[model samples]
Target chain A: MEENKKTCLHDKHVALGALMSPFGGFDMPIQYEGIIEEHNAVRNACGIFDVSHMGEVFISGPQADAYVNYIFTNDILSVEPGQCLYGMMLHEHGGTVDDLLVYKRNSNDYLLVINASNIDKDVAWIMKNAEGYDVVIDHRSDELGEIAVQGPLAEEIVQKVLGLSLSHLSFYTFGEFTIYGDKPAIISRTGYTGEDGFEIYTDHESTRRLWDELLAAGAKPCGLGCRDTLRFEVGLPLYGDELDDDITPVESGLSMFVKVDKPEFIGREAIIKQKEEGPKKKVVGLEILDRAIARHGAEVLDADDNVIGTVTTGYRGISVDKSIAMALIDARFAARDTQLKVRVRRKVFPAVVIAKKFYKKSYKK
Target chain B: MSKIYYAETHEYIRVEGNEGYVGITDYAQKALGNVVYVDMPEVGDEFEAGDDFGAIESVKAASDLICPASGEVVEVNDALVDNPRLINEDAMKNWIIKISISDEAELDDLMDLEAYEKYLESNPH
Candidate 1:
């Protein structure tokens, strides 16, 4: 395999004795102290993540809403001026182009946060989709960087560092603010970990300075390992794991976000068709009975030795002390009480399909 | 008191009479990060040299516990089911499994403390 590209924080991570690995085209830190400890830290205290590798694209124009709503699967028009919408851009054939968070700055301007690996493809896809529409799309993925401060106490660290109270911010809301008067950036109360946190979008050139600033302000720097466990515990859908081009949003149990009532979106017809005809499969969560973990490609088998599904993602689930996983399988097998077998290499571990929300949120809803 | 011997697979073995206490090395535990689960061997199982006796599942990956020396499983660490960190806290002191060694000569092939550290130098995570 080829050597992975390094992020701006590569030197900082190496100096901190972080274990580095290639993730989404960037050489990133996998862990610092450990995965579970950092996970628990984010749960109980606060942790800062170097999420600069995530792509940030800016789309501006008077017809931004019309263009956004036409291509995105969600009702992007519902997003308030200072709020962000977690949505998906769809391929014409109903597959997902990319799962994104479209932050509306105003009626005319919007920022689309997309996955790092999908940035180039997303830009090309978005451009191709907007060929006839009257809109200007900018793939500022290289010009911008992002970081997330997550957990229960993240609000305090943000306020302390930037001298601003995030108390006024609601979930999925954002505002452009200046940090120490160097450059203005977007700070949003949103995160992947299902915790009370914020994702800051700033200039790519100024990110390293701000990262050091946040750490100096007493935010514990966390790594990717903890991010996986934190997101897994809450049953958040991670791209390439819970989501991919091979799986439709409806099949991944994200049908709730797909508004069939919305007229003429890219994948609307397919989503409506699926709703009317019923999908072949549905995603379900599994809680293992033993110590064995269900990995991304592990087979979810039945008692009869037939493979029913494949485990999408899994983790230790530090708080629960057992393995928990999500799997997209035959819709007929999507029952809360249904038992399944996960083959972990040679051993077969017993598992059961459970309702979503592996860990309940205590957020200010 | 048992004398501790180390395996080339990074497992530690403590010899008490003909019985051998088995667990992973400290280096392996540190590399594994926070251990979430310890899959143990069945108490009645007998294993050959280099056979995977059990596994330790961390948050990222599930790793096998290769048998350093072959033996019948006399005991398995049930405490590690919940407290797998014991392997990290004290690897040699807290044995994961105890086995009756088939041959004492096979133990010589295993690396000792000084040689094991030397082996770790070539292979880095």
Candidate 2:
């Protein structure tokens, strides 16, 4: 078995007595103080996350814009420089390769931020499809470290602690700046949590220094445990849970990100076909009536106890104060207010279909 | 005072006559972090030794509660139904279920408090 990789701040996490666990090939922190405490910190105040495991790839050259649009589901042509668009790279059969953020630096230069687990697969897929296009693909998964400072006070904390002015940057936008005298850094007004936040990418040394400074400034050090809960509550689809090689963006309830109207793109035909024919399964929200948490892989059943779907993610929501889950169920049972059941072990808890967003997103729009 | 015994899986049984109060150990609760829910068996449920009677869910994952002795559940911890954090506060006090031990011989197989502490020392988490 291959040994798990460690980030630059792995020692810091250990020093703080964090619960370390393996995630996406990296030995990452699962929680610092506790999951509930860290989760509440992110929702009520600022929390810092070590997101360096995320992959970064730079696509440049004249064909970068068109090439990105071809591989990605979203229309990159619509976004201007310094703006980032969230979309997925899809297989020809409409299954998701990975959901990612495309930062359009210029007409010919773009940066693609992909999930940590899909780094190798995404880079290989991009290279294989780069056959005729004149695009330079720079895979920088290891060269940089990233951190997300999230919550309502993120803007103030970033400005006060990091010395970065984010008042001008709107949501889903990025700006390049120099840190520690000539070290290039990218700060983006984007995050997975529903709150307003910024993701800062810089060299490993600078990242370590920045992490120390942010911690000193009282930004809570969060881990992947709360990250999952926060994102799930906001209805953000995790790569493995809400999407996979077999699940399409349309079926994941992410059709808004997949621009099928675009004349050409990988999996466009399949996506359009699925859109026309209607999806067989759909990702929806379930509010379990009981406190018993219906976890991932738990069976979702119809009234008659027939298995109809599987839970992708579920939690006893800290902010929402209820048992909620996101499940991929048959499209026939996807409507809101539809009664269902989730078999959480020996017992089946009553559930009702609701809008996927269990918590209102507090983005600084 | 009841005599306490522990299973390798971290469950503890406090024996008082033929009845044993079953709950997870303090180490188990500390390891599990915050307790969000407790899936308890209904009263009168019978279980063989080592059978999973219920589950204790934290914020991140769930762990099954294994029975340390053959028994029939006489009473379930109704307090855990609404607030599972009672275990986290004091695992020894917040018993998950009170069971009538069907086979007292099974108690010989469990570790005493001293032996359980030694076991924890030898097997560090």
| DockQ top scorer | 2
Which ten-residue region of model 2 chain A has the weakest summed lDDT?
A157-166
Candidate 2 docking quality: incorrect, acceptable, medium or high = high
Residue B125, model 1: lDDT of: 64
- Candidate 1: tens digits of C-alpha lDDT, residues A8-100: 667888998998888988899989888877888888888989898888777878787888888777887776799888878876656787888
True A-B contacts kept by model 2: 0.94
- Fraction of the true interface contacts (Cα pairs closer than 8 Å across chains) found in each model: 0.88, 0.94
Off by over 4 Å in 1: B1-5, B16-19, B44-46, B103-105
Which residue window of length 10 is worst by lDDT in model 1 chain A?
A356-365
- TM-scores of the candidates in the order shown: 0.93, 0.99
At residue A279, candidate 1 shows an lDDT of 79
For each predicted model, how many residue pairs clash, with residues at least 3 apart or on different chains? 0, 0
> Which pairs of residues collide in model 2?
none
| lDDT of each residue in A1-365, candidate 2, tens digit only | 99999998999999999999999999999999999999999999999999999999999998998899999999999988999999999999999999999999999899999999999899999999999999899999899999999998788888887676779999999999988788899999999999999999999999999999889888999999999999999999999999999999999999999998899999999999999999999999999999989989999999999999999999999999999999999999999999999999999899999999999999988
lDDT of 1 by residue, B1-125 (tens): 77777876789888889999899888888888667778888898999989999888778888899998889998998888778877778766777899999998898888878888988997776
